[model samples]
Target: MSLSPAFLDELRARTSLSALIGKTTKLQKAGREFRGCCPFHNEKTPSFYVNDDKGFYHCFGCSAHGDAIRWMTDQRGLPFIDAVKELAQSAGLEMPATDPRAAKKAERQKGLHEAMEDAAAFFTEQLHGIAGADARAVLEKRGISAETARTFGFGFAPDARNRLRTALKSYGDAMLVEAGLLIQVEGKEPYDRFRGRLMIPIRDPRGRVIAFGGRIIGDGEPKYLNSPDTPLFDKGRTLYNLDRAAPASRKSARAIVVEGYMDVVALAQAGIGEAVAPLGTALTEAQLERLWRMVDVPIVCLDGDAAGQKAAMRAAHRALPMLAPGKSLAFVTLPDGQDPDDLVRSKGAAPMEKLLAETQPLVDRLWQAELAAEPLDTPEQRAGLKQRLADLIRPITDASVKYEYQAEFRRRFDAHFSPQRRPFVPFEKRTGGKRPAGRSGWQPALPVTEDAKKVHAAGIDRVLAKAVLAGLIRHPAEIARHMEVLGSLRLADGALGRLFEAVVDLAVEEQALDSTRLVTILARSGLGDVAGELLRADTMPYSFTQKSADPVRAQADLDEAIAILVARPEVDMMLADATSAMQSRFTDDAFERQVALVREKQALELRLANLVQANEDARALGPEEN
Candidate 1:
């Protein structure tokens, strides 16, 4: 769905940026803006700056800045729809449905959430009623305390089909089906999915009941009955105990991810308040992002079994690219055949706490595990291991973490593995045949792409967007000048342009607007990063003169910039190709026809290059030069 100016206007009018961001991270006044360490990226020094009066935040460290909607989407890992919904909720503003489809989705989500809540209440009542004795006995055997069960909202699903089905009949069969309370029979009635089991209500990080997990009391075919995939509940996306653990996770600057409902409950019960687990599913990016939102360091607490260790490794591998600087992961090994639940019950909270504190870094675990499995004594084995290590480390994009592992590998292998060895005769070594640089005779090149450069240049539209926005705020009359420039470009119709329009509308309303307020309003609209990039893009020289600290220095810088732009051979070549294609439009000479759209884009780039150069020269010569 497109982000419209009207939606942004509604969002800005309703919500306060400080209240929204302040709830997650501690913010303090720094000049006119509020400063806090970024919640998206780990940082010891504050880089997340929020201008309360302006209503915008920018993270200089990670380059993650956006309005409240954008912040909620990026920081809380919520989908765009959910992010808007959350902001609307915070503002006590009911977001109007843009379409019937959105309304239907919302209705389904609401019904499922409501059903889950009702089901939880039903199970809780049962736990205190007829099924209470059996469930409590099981908890006692598992060494779970009364307080622990209460804290986790533990319940019991009676062996009857009509128990919750009867209680929630008013919600209708569709709701029951969505909530996974009843399994459908072809051309017949629905039957209870979870019966004769202890019910565990699974909640999202916001403490909203979205689903249920039921563990059978005794011998059963399928051990657990999890809620079906519903609008509100996605097993892969939801983390068990996230709601209870997130506040603590933020406070501690760390979170522990376990594998089961019991593990999370046991950890929390045993005083490990920062522990959470994925709901009846493998770790997913959604869950990882959620964990990322809460804390800087997220520890993967795996059970000491083969399957569990494998799962932890998979999770770490998946998380590698998304792992920003300062964010860390550790692997904690419980005793063999023991999970958090078993360990906490057997050894108490202190041992579990110690294990968490003493968990090994994920990278260290990987290297240690790799070396232990491979016979690295022989030169061939060592060399193979080195390549394997490099291959494993290649996917790790985080420079700091990747380099740390590289340094560790160097330290471990330098003495023996550093020396070059050959399989052929010693005489062949004199021929100077060394292994080809990079992996498998094919290595991906760095230093950006032509497309990336195009995209970066396309980013100039963003600068103009910011200019249009800033101009509208400062001198509403100047907005027409900026828009005229923008109109000539036919900038891509998307979030950036929509935001520019929103700023213009606001400027029209305010008469004289503040840039920070515009930024804040833009931030609330959920395009903070795009707006920030636009605002932070290259400053034009005459514009600087208009806000003059010094026009002469600006002019000199502008001239140098233009010279640099003109010297780009690649850009010039691209521009020449574009202009030739444009000229071809008038001729019927069977020429090497340039692709129409690509040619126009290239021509635009050429025009931009010339414009930049001319602007630079004009700035260097002062206002009289124009």
Candidate 2:
């Protein structure tokens, strides 16, 4: 039972060597491949490696090497035919029948491959001939050297429609047409598909020319044209320069994805050989998988213009669902209006190298793209941003990775939209010992006296402070609503002040702040003693302090406490100033101001007393009534 090479190649491409070997080998991802102990021999250190991209397994210990079928035969002890049949069945491939027609078809494909090679040879000859002087000039203008041109198999397709057909007539017109070298119609005779253009050969993994991409020499509507899908090539699965870049990527431990073939060539010219490009389309899943096989994180270096950015985002979204642990993409945004090719030409490869070195991970790029998708000023727009982020994270198949992405996005959203306050500073330090200028010759109100400081310090109720802080911890969602009021008022107790600041900062940074996580983070930040004291059972009898407290009533009570706390400081400041003014002038207006301050202070005290009384009454009523 003989199988065609095409069938075997397709089988290898479809079958994942890692999944097959992992059944017994316990493989772990190591860079672009999976590594485990060699199953054929006793070894604890994991010398055996499997590469699904290349569809092969190798053992450094025993020097065992083969592909899917070989593994099935050697490891499973199956004969060649049985192994091939099993692999074919698993790969969803029908084993090729031993028939005359099947053999003829395989032979025909072989002829097609030969025909494409012949066409490439002819194009290369024409590029160096007098007829290709213009093409050579184009290459020179684009900084393509003669050696690089020859190495990449650069060639020219003359303007004449019959030039390629005439040169390769011995291979038969049908073969050339089937190979995508000539255009055939029902009524019209077959003619050259690529004419008056510069030709670059597109090859497979084994470095065999499977197709050609042609770029027009001068101004034209469709500047670039690629060969149509033939039996030998699938454009969506093919990447330009992959044949040459795979090994370079292995050595460099990275791969660079550019937008065009010329960019790959330019980077290669600049001595960076691990670069490839999609064949005239947005990156496909197959293409991305191929890139991941070469390196865990391939740097997608697209142009920095609007269209290019849009293309980069398209690649990112396409890759989201396919992301796995240790397998993802990184992106490099070239200088504005520039590409890898342009960057290399202008400033040498150093800038391009730097950009590649500092590539942004796919998640970061996705966040940035969605952040810039629309304005987040309105509530609806902000909700849309959150919804979009959720939508992006929904496609990720890995549970752990998806959870991490959700956390990261939530953190970013909170940081961006939540109100952030500067670190607290002393008034003297903030003012640099000089008061800010106000209206000319109108000095600001005098500072509070030492007596007033002592009065205000003694006025802060520790029980009230602990109750408020505990309530916030219990219902962390209410923290955002009270952030503005809480930010303005300073807690008088040192431990309480640090705890309050930590809670506010946590609310600003973490959108999904549960009581447990809030408390845990606070404890980690060296506030464990303060947190424990605040959360103690006897800390306060307020409904908000209890775990079973009604969120609505608790929030209301918390808001009331916050209002009283904020008002107290304002009243103290006003009363101190009014007292000073009365002592200095004793005018009717000043006396009235002092009277108003006294009344306001009395009202705030009454409110605080009533709040404590209401909580105690609720506590007496028990959890059901409260």
Candidate 3:
């Protein structure tokens, strides 16, 4: 639920920005403001200044300046709502519900939070109080120090029925069931799912316990067992140790992503504190994108075994296209047959530190890994490897970075696979005018049909509407140029339209829109794809260096694209059928037929004009065209 501007203003006034930020960074009295090194970026100079009177702070060095909320958002790398929630918690203030649905969702989240807190306390008690000696011994045997165990809130669940059920009696049986802390049995009773294990509480970025990760204390089928999906926890959506790592990320300006919870814990314990791990999943695009926001670079730490190597390679492949020139990755490989936990235990924190210090850049590691595989002796292998390298490099929009990678790929490909005399044969067939001289009409290697195009176009439109709304709302001047276009068009009627409406409404009410509020909206609207598309579209603001930057020019370009789409031969055929149907409805109106023809002619004329404008060498339109 969105707070009123007046309410937000009041909340901002109530909280002391200087005091809140002073707790983290050492601030000194300047003339009229407090000054300190920026917390959000690495800097030696005292560029970050906070003006208590203005309720704002600015970093002259980095230009990271904003209001109190923006300051917290920058510092924590959290969404605005998350930052507001953080600040509200600190102030012991409740968020006023602005809508009924939001109020209900908030109520559900509070229940889940309470359940998780209860489960954590119960598990913690079990570790120390009774029937947890065996689990403690297992930790000792694994070389986990008592201090380390306490630091991570390590615990165990007894191998018995209703342990957590009895512990969380206040929240109700439904709470425990929903929280995935207890599993119901048909005849007997509900039992704790994470019994006979060393517990690792999976906290959110706010440090609230959302789920648990358990390591087998005894001989068990699965080495690690995690809490099942609940209203609060989705393993894929979270990063282990994000609570601790996020602050470190903001300070250090980088984060290290590892393969396991142990890797994250061990690294943090080892003083490589800015480390997090994906919860029992591959390093996803979503996880990577989120990490990039928190840190300038995210080093991927993978295991040394075959599976680890594969995981690392997969991460590198996923990350390459997203890598900007300034952004980067490093690969950390633990010793053979060892994970980060084991390495830290056997070799101590110093060795782990040394490993991080000696980590290889992702590009170097990826190149070495690719080259380490079977020889480029065969033509097929050479072609396959070259294609694989190209697939990884082409999506990056940065020309300099792409060019560097392209040159590096070509050099490496030549060094590894190229025969001394024979030229490398292209993998994909060339098409269009570039095709072999004897070839007839250029056919798409993979032609998307009209049905596919319609579906894809709808998806693209959903993404476009969300993106355009976000852009236009942020830049008010854009509203006049784009609103009519947005209003005239029809998108796929569903959750996406609802979300677009919500954003537009928010913009209308607040005169500014917060992207975070849209998150819950998008999630509720069942528009995850649209949300993901919006999140993933890393659009750089257009600079008015070209004619395309003008609103008229840009819209004209868009209109042309739309006109061409409407005037497609397939579309023309479809329009003919539509017109015939309309004719039947009209009964006997020759004027209707003429009017339809005239509209079609106008559309064709627009398409022709666009073609001519876009391509100066295009043919001219005559009076007959009208």
Candidate 4:
């Protein structure tokens, strides 16, 4: 089968050479290409390389080389047709039917390319002629040198209607209309589509003029206009200045995206050659993919105005679903009320270079955009912010990148919303060598209080203690309700006491506390091990300890457990005192008191036992009930 060059070009553009060659060889990134040991010959060091941007593979050691089709036929031992078939299938493209019409279509497209080139040359001649005096003045006013204009193939469209129609009349009116150079109506004659405008040719990767972008010289409704999509041009898939920018990007190890063709030209004039621009539209997925083929992270430098920021956000949203490891976008916002063109004109290229040097990653820009979307002063607004973030990251297809983004967003959310902790200072330093206003200079050192001694004497139920602490950690919102009662209580285990104190302090510090943020804070404070121990599945048989338990039910059960825990020590202390009094002086009242205290302690223990049994039943019923 004789395949058309158009179909073959599409195949090459769609297939990633690195990925195709990587199946048999371990290829590591080496600048703009991938390098690995030569698969064609025995070698210890890497001498083979693949350049996806150029769609070719070369082996320095064995001189083995090919494109995707060559690799499939030579290495995989398949025929030409089979190789094309396999690549077409993988690229989600339909195999072109065996027909002579496809060849004719390709020939016609080649003719259209010739027509576009002729039109470009005609416009360039007109730009240097007498009719282009106004165009030259416009370029001069914008600080574009004659040399720069010549390098970029700057041109002009005369204000008259038939200037191009008469110049390129040999290509026929049909070819000119097909090339998007002339507009045709039902009965009216086809005239030039661009008039009284400065022209910039849009070229393909091979430097063939595919279309033109025209900027109105002065006083126009639309300041800029682009050619309609034709066989040679798909605006969404094309980036302005890509033919020149690709090689420059490979050398710089970076690529930049600006808002307009003029900005790209300005940057190029300033010796910044690795810059391109979308064709008067928001950045698209095809353009982003094209950029990634050149560099790992391309910098998108949009204007700093509201529309520019919105355009940047749109680009970010377009990139999220396609993000892969080491393949993402960075962003740069130019100074206020200025674009790359304006900045270069005012302060030269240093500020533009500095901004590019310090570009923000896609994640930071996403966070800032969402944070500034609305005021997060209310609970509802804050929750909306988190929900928006979740929605934004949900589209990320790469598992590892998605996970990292989630973790980073969570960390940022906690850092932004959680209150800052005060730095610790010694009491003497804080007081500046003076006693507190209400306290005497010399205060008595008190002995171990009665409550502390009683807490030590009454051995705690280890299982119940774990359950209560875990419940509090899982449901941090309930901490404030029980803070006063818990403040006066003491635990015998030093680690457990420290954990309790930390929890209480966190509750006091953060107004909006969640379980994840609470655990994160505890982990940062070196209480992670203790917290982890308490949160173990086998450590407690309680609904509140389960992570997926219902919030209302968890809070209620946690409250009951806390009540029982707090009242137990008092019952134990009263019981001990009554028994001691009875032993000291045998009396009926003392005996009665000891009996009542014993009954109260038994009731508390029984309640604790029932609560555990209820939790066990709930656990057996599964998470629905919990």
Candidate 5:
């Protein structure tokens, strides 16, 4: 069996040299190629290079060079025939049958090439000829320039079926039929296959015309038509504009995959020359392999229409199972109802360029696509979402890449449904514990301003509440231990209440916030001014809130202040009740109650008096404490 040159090129194009060798030798990306220590020789620094573009592995150190077939034979000890057979199978190519016509494979291929090229030239000339004026008009209407038309070999097949046959009779009917230019019916003459359509020539890697694609000139069925799978053309294996795109991709460091030939042509016209398109089918794994040979991550530009989004989704799903580290796809969907052609024509190229520049990664697109697939409100639904994510992750071919993707999903899952802390709520009037947890109190600071000397309008309770809140901002680490108790406190100042809630939320969200980071986070969350005012030393002359301040003394002052604040409210209620009873016609029991209430009020007043003296003493010793 003889393998044709076209088949060999296809085979090599379908293979990834880095992957083939990387199975055994560790490899790392180096720009457009992969590099590692030469597997053939022992070396410390990497001197080996495997270039997917050139389809070969080379060692600068040991002077080794070979293609995949040769690597299999020399590196893996496979025989030549065995290597060829294995590669053909992997590339989805069948071994040619050994027939008497096998020896004339080259001649037969040459004849097919002559016929296809002739058809392409005839189509072009006719497109320029008198009969092709309508096709030329169509091109002009689509904004296809003369230079682009010539560069891509735009042409139009005559409406009549036999017009091309008459023009290319020299290549003979048998050759024309074999080239897929004419379709044959049983017991009937073959006629031109593409009729009344604008023609596009598909070229091989070396820029040889291998097949033709046609777009109907006007309203018709089968909007786009491609050449059948002939000896020279396999639509599934071919990407439109790849011959030009491969070289262009190297310069831009990006390969773009669109959905159609006009999309490719439109981008090239807009100065984006690295665009390609699958041949009338969803992007295939083989085509993806070919794209990776040019650039690391190629971008898939789809239209924003529903069908376009579905196409983008289809490509993403096909790519998921094939993902490896440093090898994945990026996606950018154009505006609704706009393909690349429409986008460039309507908005110029800057918008499209900006969109491509900000293309999302594969995993992000995956998360977004799957997340939007269904609503995740219930536990079962959320868990199902996780399972969907895991299902997508499970297909990743690389173990390390799979693990990292799993980790990414795990992070997203946590962010979505982790135990939600109570939303940041402003402090409200509330009754909590009647006493402090311990001797919670704080240290005193040097009076920062005359403002600090102002007496609390609500007296020591307000002063103490302000003091405790300020201490937390100075020492956020102390928050974790007293979150519940602090959460229960109700402050009189509304702004101060909001600040308290924000600080508690911050503490709960981040368990290990230091004073600096905590303050920064709060400042970023629109609380900079609030935090500043609440934490200002000038708010209270006797407040201590510096790195050098004693946490023990701070807790002591805070606890004592809390106990007094909580107990003061109860005392007021008792005094009010006793005062009410004493005001009414009272018996001996009511009289006793009044005496007891008076005693309680006196005791509470004494405690408040001591708190005043403690503040005075703290103010006096503030300089010494600092």
Candidate 6:
């Protein structure tokens, strides 16, 4: 039975050399490698060492050197096949099927690997040769030193498609195509897949060249291109620079995920060496779990833009469903419109370091994403937020971890949505219809004026919109404070939206406009009754007390109310669309969509109810206690 080289490599990688050696002899950590007395012979000097990085244990005392499998066979007196089987079981690897052609397959793979290595060397030579002047100039412009270029094995693939095929005639086109160095199509000759671009050799975890990535040096569509999935490479499972970054991670206790391979190279060039990138795909579960094997919390340094933010959210959402105790991702959003490559190039290493150091937890990022995705002023919207949080948390399979997350979410919800206390405790709830003592321990009571502003005749959305408009009118100068948010808002009431826009336009034109002046301007716009109704004390959904109604606080609260007012209509339309879509017979895709929409509607309704409840929390106390 011929064992495949990949299967053998898998077995070796999964085996802990130190553990295999330690069972028979004592071991001590000596830097990256472990040291122990030679188990092969009697010696106290300790000339034995197991190098996990190298995947072999060696003894100077006796010429004993082998990997976990060899040690099992040599020292434990097990047959070769039995040893491999035992180790495979221990490492949780399935045994490859026995095949008579396995030896030929393995030989072919070795040839392909050698061919790729030779191709990498040729490309590197081309980078240094006179033919690579343009590539070298681009390198110089990027500040990649000769030494750095050599370290990253930066190279150039010439524009001539047949250059590689001609030079590598020894390997022939068949193996080249198999190795992905040449592209093969029906009725077409094999040609180079990469040409006229900067070349990057992608290696596997064991530092073997399995694939290649190319970046266009000039105007091009993709900007960056990677090898397609082949027998030798799976883009989704491989990180661009893991072979170096894995060892580097041992020193830094962190791994940085960036957008492109060049970002990794740039960070490595800048002395921040612990960086890796997914091969032309969004961060996946396999990629994340691989990182977790290296560090407790990997830093996901994303580009600071809308697209980057969306990517971060996708990663966060994927991670939420797989979270375990002491395992998660930290997010570092680069400055707006900048990637690691851009940032490191402009600001050098310090700013990148600062951003990496000040990382945000995955949970906080998740909350921010959902919270900002929609308005939460209405009870339905707020409830929607809570429900989204729950859906995200429900994926935590670990009971203790799930419970702790639940508690944290509960605490946040309470902080944002807890019922406000009445100015004075209600007589029946506090004293069972009995009069309570005064503050000075005396039985004195004074008639209290109810906050008549708490009641509203209009719908909750309309009430909140009126309160926001009233706040803006009452403190016209404060309109500047929320102009950006107000301008962006799409109020559920069309008339209100138009009125709000006019108010903003006036605010910009007349900065010093006061409440009376603003109302006079609106009266001329034929929105005088709307303005009048909004300004009435009875339209206020929540009691913004004389103190709380200061320009700054009112502006903030008014913004929150406006968010709710705008969100309700958006939710209604979405719900209606979703309901209409569900009228069709349910398929797998439709079922998922229906479930998601129903869940969203539930949360929205809950949020609207919560906002209403919060407003109602302000009570009408008949008498004040002194």
Best by lDDT: 4
Worst 10 residues of 6 by lDDT: 444-453
TM-score ranking, best first = 4, 6, 2, 5, 1, 3
TM-score of 3: 0.54
Over all chains combined, what TM-score does candidate 1 have? 0.55
Off by over 4 Å in 6: 27-66, 73-98, 419-626
Clashes of each: 12, 0, 0, 0, 13, 14
Model 5, position 371: C-alpha lDDT score: 90
Clashing pairs in 3: none
Q: lDDT: which is higher, 4 or 5?
A: 4
Give the local distance difference test score of model 5.
Answer: 0.77
Report how far off residue 397 is in candidate 4 (Å). Answer: 3.4
What is candidate 2's lDDT per residue for 459-578, written digit by digit as tens? 554556678888888889989988787787656758788898999999999988999999899989999888877777654756678777556556766887878766776688778877
TM-score of each: 0.55, 0.64, 0.54, 0.66, 0.59, 0.64
Candidate 3 residue lDDT tens string, 1-626 = 74654456667877888998899899999854799999878999899999764578888988988877987787768899988888888877788767986666656668888888877777888899668999888777776678878888988887877777887788776677778888877786666777778789999765889899988877977999999998778877788988888767756666888788777777777777888988888888878877876765677778889898899888888887688877877888878877887788777888877787887887888777766665766778776676666656656655456545655665565444422333323323323333354333333222334743564455333333444544443343444444555455555677666656655554555544444554555567576566556555445222111222324333333444443433444444444444545444422243344345445544554444433332221111111210
lDDT of each: 0.67, 0.83, 0.67, 0.84, 0.77, 0.76
Residue lDDT tens for model 4, 1-626? 45777899999989998999998889999976899998889999999999988888999988999899999998999999999999999999999887788877877888899999999999999999999999999999999999999999999999989999999999899989999999999899999999999999999987999999999988895789899999999999999999999989988889999999999999999989999999989999889989998898999999889898889989999999999999999999887788999999778989988988999999999999899989999999998997788778877777567656755776688668755545445456767895455532322222234653546485554456668888988888888898898787766667887998899899989968987899889999999889987777654666689876645546666887998888877776766666556555544465456656666766676667655654554455454322
Q: Which 10-residue span in candidate 2 carries the lowest summed lDDT? A: 438-447
TM-score of candidate 2 against the unseen true structure = 0.64
Residue-level lDDT of model 5, residues 1-626, one tens digit each, is 67666667678878988999999999999988899999898999999999888788999999999999889999999997788889888878887777667758767997888787778888889989999999999999999999999999999998887998889998888888888899989899989999999999999766889888889988998988888988888888789899899879988999999989999999999999999999888999889888887887999997789998898888988987788778999999777888999989788799999999999998899999889989889889987897787677655665556546754676576666644434332212123434333312211112112332232223325656666667778877777887777777666656777777888999999988887788798789888787777666653633344344435445544555556666665655555555555455434455455556555555555554544443443344344332
lDDT of 1 at 26: 99
